[model samples]
Target: MAFSADELRVLRRALAVALHPAPLHDEDVQDALLLAASVDEAVREAGRLRAFLLADLARYREALPGSLSGYLELLRDALAAGYDPQADDLAALRALRRNPAASELLARCRILAERSVRARLARVSQATATSAPTGPRARLFALPGGRAADDEPKPNPPAPAERPVPKPSEVFPPRRRPVPPPPPEERAAG
Candidate 1:
């Protein structure tokens, strides 16, 4: 298998956490480990089939020694399983002495497989790079302009207000204060 024991263990742990999530789990968590093991076993078996078929196609070369279509089918399977038929894989294919038709088919398969691997890897790498965070500290810097750190929003400032001037009547209306007349005895003396 291409994966080491530790890799499979990590894969299992990840699967288990995804299946039955818990907060306080360590590297050797139980349920996740079991699920990971099961997944690893399945993947290993599938890989074996893919590798065997790819190897056979690379070793055989005949116009119809074993059906050009059949060889192409094997290559498709390998590609689907994430195999990259690059220089090494092509070298293996070149070693085969199949007929012209089979050779052509194998060549096409190799090209397609290589393309698929490259495209998928590119997508995966792009996703990883985009999601990778630089650091928490970088978020503290001030943005663009030299505005104050806590400046209030200025998108829409208060509109110019129009104060109504008071009319003379409104400013000084007649008062109803009581007026005191001269004393009654003074009036009688007069």
Candidate 2:
């Protein structure tokens, strides 16, 4: 989308006018309009190109092993054009992983697929986090007794039972008494 020198000049003038609040001349206005139209056309052309590439990629994928080389080439081009690899594309690449090119493409496609999954999950999580109720929700109907759910007294969880403390003797057995002087007598005799 390289702009012509004349279009660049017009763009710069338009920016200046936007910043400075000056009235655009008839020629400047016409140039700006023309540049805008050119940009729109370029965007449309890019979309069409993307659509064509995707269609070509699908055809190549359908052809399978017979079109391995062409499929790989088309897949590369599609990836370069920011195509999000679909499950079918990943499965096809996986099937052709015997090919070095297919293996490389499968790795790249896996990364793209993971990123897409993560992005979708992030969006869903973000939406749920934002839209989910944060406070106590109001009950639509009363309980069996016509009492609001919130108005009922909440039951408290049971307290844990206390265990009896073990005596010191139970925790640690008493040490045996030392041998009497008989040991010393025996040593002296020896």
Candidate 3:
């Protein structure tokens, strides 16, 4: 999807601020917020490009003889078809516009589709690399990589400990007893 000049300028500014070492600085905070906003814009652009591509491809399919086989060939050589969008995907878009061998609108549409796919891929990759993991461990504890305040130690109150109680068994002593047996009964029986 094409970025408006203003949006591109904003992206550039945000990127610069985010990459700066002093994130705690006021400018850095503003930069971070701008970057977050840009993310939503990027998503919207991607959606727009996806719709445009699909519509173009449908048009191409209806117009050409052996168009299905031609698309299959394009798929097989898709990587060679091009993925880079140097200085924006202008060159690739131009190439699409020039293809008289195929339906002009359909070819352009496919180009738009490829460009959208590539743009989204790049954005997702960038986001994944920068964003913290949303796993259980990340949720339970703050890591060093988090914001500056996350590194600060929290204050905790000291606990009061009580003395342990002594057991009754420890203070008591054993009593001695005299034993009497069955000697008298045995003598009587005998």
Whose lDDT is greatest here? Answer: 2
lDDT of 3: 0.56
Model 2 C-alpha lDDT versus the unseen true structure: 0.91
Candidate order by TM-score, highest to lowest?
A: 2, 1, 3
Model 2 bad stretches (over 4 Å): 132-190
Instruction: Kindly list the per-residue Cα lDDT of model 1 for residues 1-190, writing each as its tens digit.
Output: 4656766767766767679986736635664566567778988988888778766757542433445467556666666666666665465456553656547756776677768778899999999999998667554676755567347565654557656789998999978788788899989999
Model 3 is weakest, by summed lDDT over 10 consecutive residues, at: 83-92
- Between candidates 1 and 2, the one scoring higher on TM-score is 2
Clashes of 3: 0
**Model 1: C-alpha RMSD to truth?**
26.8
For candidate 1, the 10 contiguous residues with the lowest summed lDDT are 59-68
| Residue-by-residue lDDT tens digits, candidate 3, 18-97 | 69744465765675577667777888987776566545544544444446455434423332444232222233334444
In model 2, the worst 10-residue window by lDDT is 141-150
TM-score of 1: 0.33
Give candidate 3 misplaced runs (Cα > 4 Å).
Answer: 1-23, 65-190
